[model samples]
Target: MGQDQDTLSVVALCQSERVLWMPDGSPHSPRFKDRYRSRSGGLAQAMTVFLAGAGLPVGWRGRNRFSVLETGFGLGLNFLCTWAAWEADPQRCERLQFASVEAFPVSAADLVRSARNAGPEDQPECSIALRLPVLAEQLAQVWQGLSPGIHQWRFAGGRVQLTLAVGEVQATLQDLDCQADAVYLDGFSPALNPQMWSAQTLHLVAQHCRPGATLATYTVARSVRERLRQLGFSVEKCPGLPPKRDRLQAVLRP
Candidate 1:
C-alpha cells in the first residue's frame, strides 16, 4: 500500500485538453470542433443523458459494488454528478467505481472552473448545486501529478474512487482492467472525434463491460446504433435534451 501511494506521484508531464470558452460559457474543443457540454449545463447533461439513461442511482441500488467506464472523460461533469447522486441516494451501492479515458486532459484549474461555471447564471445547477463546488475542490486537490498513465484517487472515505487514464483512448482502455456495470459513451461529436467513437474503440469498450451492462450516449447516429447492435447491444433512441432531439440507450444482452 505504501509503494502504491508512492508511485502515484510518478506522473510525467503532458499538456492537452485545450478549450476556448464560448460566449455562452461552454467549453469548446478546438481540436474536435465541438463543445464539451452546452450552455444549458454540464450537470443537466450528466443527470439526463448519462445517469438517467444508464438507469443509475436506481441501477446501483442494492448492489455491493457498481462500476462505470467512460470513453471520454472530457471535463468530468458526469463523474461529479454521479458521485453527488450516489451520495444522495439512500440505497446506493456500497462502492462506486468510475473509470474514464481521456487522450488530452485539461489542467486542474480547468476542472474546477468547469464545475464552478457549471450552469447558467439564471438557473442553478440541476441537483447537488450546494455540493458541486465542494466536490470540484476535492477532485482538483488530487488533479495534480497526472501524466500519460492511470491516476487513481480515493474519495468519500474510499467508497468512491476515480480512475483517470491519461493517454490515447485505445491504449488506455487496453490498460484499464475494470468490469464496468454501466458505460458512458461520451466525447466530442462522432464526426469530430472519430477515434473515440470508432468501431474498434467501441469493441474494446465492450470487452470491459460485464454481461448485461447498460450504456448511454447522447448521439443517435445510425452508424453508431448499427455498430452497437452488432456488438450484441439492444440499441434504441430515447428522448434527448436539446440541442439534440434524441439520444441512444443500449443494454448488452446476456
Candidate 2:
C-alpha cells in the first residue's frame, strides 16, 4: 500500500456554536453550524466583514473592467453574491472577472447540495444562496475535469468569468497575471490555516493588486494588518458582523 486515498464529497455538520458547515478539507469552508462560512464568522463575515471591508456594492460602479481575486473559493458564496450585485446594478462594470485558488475541488453534486442547505431570501447573503442551485447546476453540467492550472468558466455572455486555479495558494496566484480591482480574503482562520494567511501568500496577492485595489477579510490580526500596511495598503479597522468585534479592510495607496 502506498498511502491512504481519501474521497471528497459535501457533508454537513454542526459546530459547537450551532452553526452549519461542510466537511473541513482542501477547499470547503470550515465548520459553522448553519452559516456558509467558517464557524468563526457567518453571514456577518461575507456582508459586514468582507463586502463592507472592501467597500463593495459601491467600489466598481462605473469602471470598465472589475476583477476580484480570492484566496479560497470555498462554497462560492462570495462569488455568487458579487455576481448578483453586479446583475442588479444598472451601472455596473462592463466585465466582471473573479479568479480564485483552491487546493481541492468539490464535486458538482456537492455544490448543488450546498445551495439547498444554504440560507433563505430575506438575509443579504441568502440572495447568493438562492441562486447557488442554478449556478451549481450549470457548473455541474460543464465541469469536466480539473487539472492543476487555470480553468476559466464564462457566464452571462462573457460578461462574467471565473478563473479557478486548482492548486496551492502561493504558486497558483504566482502563475496568474490578473490585476485585481478587489480582493476577497475568505480562507480559514490564521490559526487553523497558516498557509492561506501567511506573509508570503499575502505578498503574492498584493503584487497582483492595482494601484487602487481594495482588500477585505474577516481577520484583524496584528500581523495581517502590519503585513498589509507594509505592502502599501492603508488598513482600517471597521465594525464587524455580530459575535465578533471588528473586521479589516484596506486599499492600496499609490
| Per-model lDDT | 0.85, 0.72
Q: Write the per-residue lDDT of candidate 1 for residues 1-254, one digit (tens) a residue.
A: 44223223322346645788877678887766888985468877888889999988899999999999998887888898899899999999999999999867887788888888776466664466556778989998888756778999999999999999977778789999899999999977887767778899999999999999999999888888998999999998998988888988999999
TM-score of each: 0.92, 0.82
- Candidate 1 residues lying further than 4 Å off, grouped into runs, are 1-13, 120-127
For every candidate, C-alpha RMSD to the true structure in Å: 5.7, 6.2
Off by over 4 Å in 2: 1-44, 121-129
- Best candidate, TM-score-wise? 1
Pairs of colliding residues, candidate 2: 19-32, 19-33, 19-34, 20-32, 20-33, 20-34
lDDT of 2 by residue, 84-122 (tens): 667767888898999998765655666556555445435
| Candidate 1 residue 248 C-alpha distance from true site, Å | 0.6
Span of ten consecutive residues with least summed lDDT in model 1: 3-12
